[model samples]
Target: MSDMRGEVILRVVPRPADINSNGHIFGGWVLSQMDIAGGIVAGRIAKGAVATVAIESMKFISPILLGDLVSVYAHAERRGRTSVAIRIDVVATRGGGAETVDLTSGVFTFVALDENHRPRLLPDA
Candidate 1:
């Protein structure tokens, strides 16, 4: 995915413990990273608290290996009365030459919430 798709929201290096028995980063770990990135973008658009309602789509394009530098990018793809769909793409930079690879991509929906924890209307963009 291009940087035009979204801003880089999160970046971190996976520790050894983050790897699965297969010697690749766990899918759940990557999913959590995407969720976090989606929530950040969604909350900013909503201008308040937001809760993840669903993962509309997800695709693991490539494996994230140990020592890979992972970066998660996200942008709001769509917005409803109280929910926003965030498209998140993850890229991994590995090896000494700084080769980049697309690792995963997903679309997640989050609902804006009021202090009462009920869904609230999203603020105007």
Candidate 2:
């Protein structure tokens, strides 16, 4: 939220159907977006296929509103021989884009995969 640390990987507007009973966007929906964003970065770092293996941590800072323009940001936080941990952050722009709200943040770990879908070493960086 403070000077957004990662690249904006995805930008989307929530639909009515994405809302929960509380009139806020579902947490699962936000989480999925985060995963997608993280996967993109992880795949780039791995230089091939990657699969989410774990979520090291997640925090929901605020609820997403129907009219908010959601932006997913991500960056590789750490890397191992076969896996990378991506830091993903979700922010919402509302009030005719005059306001920005910090929605959620998480660290998702992804493992590089080979053609056989088995874990593989990441490409040299």
Candidate 1 weakest ten by summed lDDT: 1-10
C-alpha RMSD for every candidate:
1.3, 1.5
Candidate 1 Cα outliers beyond 4 Å, as residue runs: none
- Model 1: per-residue Cα lDDT over 1-125, one tens digit each: 46676899999998988989899999999999999999999999999999999998999999999988899999989899999999999999989646999999989999999999999999887
Model 2 poorest 10 in a row by lDDT: 1-10
**CA lDDT, every model vs. true structure:** 0.92, 0.93
Model 2, span 34-94: residue lDDT tens:
9999999998998899999999999999999999999998988889999999989899999
The C-alpha TM-scores of every prediction are 0.95, 0.96
